[model samples]
Target: MTDLVQQAGIKLDATASSPEEAVDICGKLLVELGAITSSYADAMWEREQIFPSAIGMGFAIPHGTDESRAHVIFDQLVFVRLAKPISWADDEVTCVLGIASQGDGHVELLGNLAEMIQDEDKLAILQNSDNPEEIAQLLLGND
Candidate 1:
């Protein structure tokens, strides 16, 4: 939990207009939370074109790796909750995970997050939680 807290923060949205809009909104939150550089937001949008971050199961994981950005080892992680469903592939996602990584090390972290996200039980726990800290602890097994 401490590890995730060290890297990511959570933000609330009173109203998230749409799925694409949610991605843009989440990127802004990551920048404002200091989890990622503001410039990296562009890279994230580009990546979204090649691959949809909407991994289904009410989750969307977006990432960006640009040299112009901070390019830190741990990168950054941020959670975004939408007021309504957003189109992703054939599904609608409500929670978004905005991630930014600089090097190969992040692959392992990303894999772990991906696995955790795939688990229906885990995802349920996270969605039902009130804040990111609880979700982080759930993922980190800090509880």
Candidate 2:
């Protein structure tokens, strides 16, 4: 699971004017990590249009559509913390977790994220910590 979120995958001090821009930045990080092709980025935005990804606690997990799975090369997660909050649908979001997975991996990833965010201490680090290693540890656990 640690491999899913390398230090490079964690980006901080980012800025975005809108959800679209935020998603784009997330997609670009996944592409840079060679997790998915460019088309998958568009799919993520499409998914956002049909259903917003903002799950609360200032976080939004965006992923590509099922059809966009063809563009995925491997499972990967990109964490982006914006310098300021952006309006994501009805909620405000400062953290974006960009997911690139081809199969049930995404389900598992979502489950882990759901559970992690439930812990207020961990969620606070993910939201406020500037240290990439700390954020990665929070996401992947003490291991």
Candidate 3:
């Protein structure tokens, strides 16, 4: 998972004036890494249209629907920390975590992520870190 994040790319302190731009930043990285097709980004946007991805505490997980799974070539995760918070529906989001998985791994990934963020210290690190590697370590327990 950490390798996927390193390969997919992480953008720290990135500036995006809107939620769409934030999602685009992470999606583009996945596309560049060949983890997903270009259309996957649009799929993410469409999913967002159906329901906001913001999960709370300034974090948002933007992903495509099962129908968009066809665009996924591999399991990948892209983390982006915005330079400023953007409105994702009713929530203010500063971190956009983009996920592209081909199978049930996405469910496991989300489960792990949920557990990780439940720790206040870990959540603080994720919300405040400016180093991509450090953030990855904090999230994936690579440290």
lDDT by residue for model 2 over 86-113, one digit each (tens)? 9998899999999998887767667877
Query: Per-residue lDDT of 5-100 in model 3, one digit per residue for the tens?
Result: 772378888899988888889889899888999888789988888988999878899999889989999888888888889888888898888988
Candidate 2 has a TM-score of 0.94
With candidate 3 superimposed using the best TM-score fit, by how many Å does residue 35's alpha carbon deviate from the native? Answer: 0.6
Task: Supply the global lDDT for candidate 3.
Answer: 0.82
How many pairs of residues in model 1 come into backbone collision? 0
Instruction: Report the lDDT of model 1 for residue 102.
Output: 61
Which number leads on TM-score?
Answer: 2
Ranking of all predicted structures according to lDDT, beginning with the best and ending with the worst: 2, 3, 1
Model with the higher TM-score, candidate 1 or 2 = 2
Candidates arranged by TM-score, highest first: 2, 3, 1
| TM agreement with the true structure for every prediction | 0.77, 0.94, 0.90
**Candidate 1 lDDT score at position 29:** 66
Residue 55, candidate 2: C-alpha displacement in angstroms: 0.7
Q: What residue pairs clash in candidate 1, if any at all? A: none
Best by lDDT: 2
Q: Mind giving the per-residue lDDT tens digits that candidate 1 earns over 1-143? A: 24544324665443665655776876776676665666677677777877887876778887774563564334566677676667876778888777766655455655776787777777776676676667766655554
Cα lDDT computed for each candidate against the true fold: 0.66, 0.89, 0.82
**Segments in model 3 whose C-alpha atoms lie over 4 Å from true places:** none
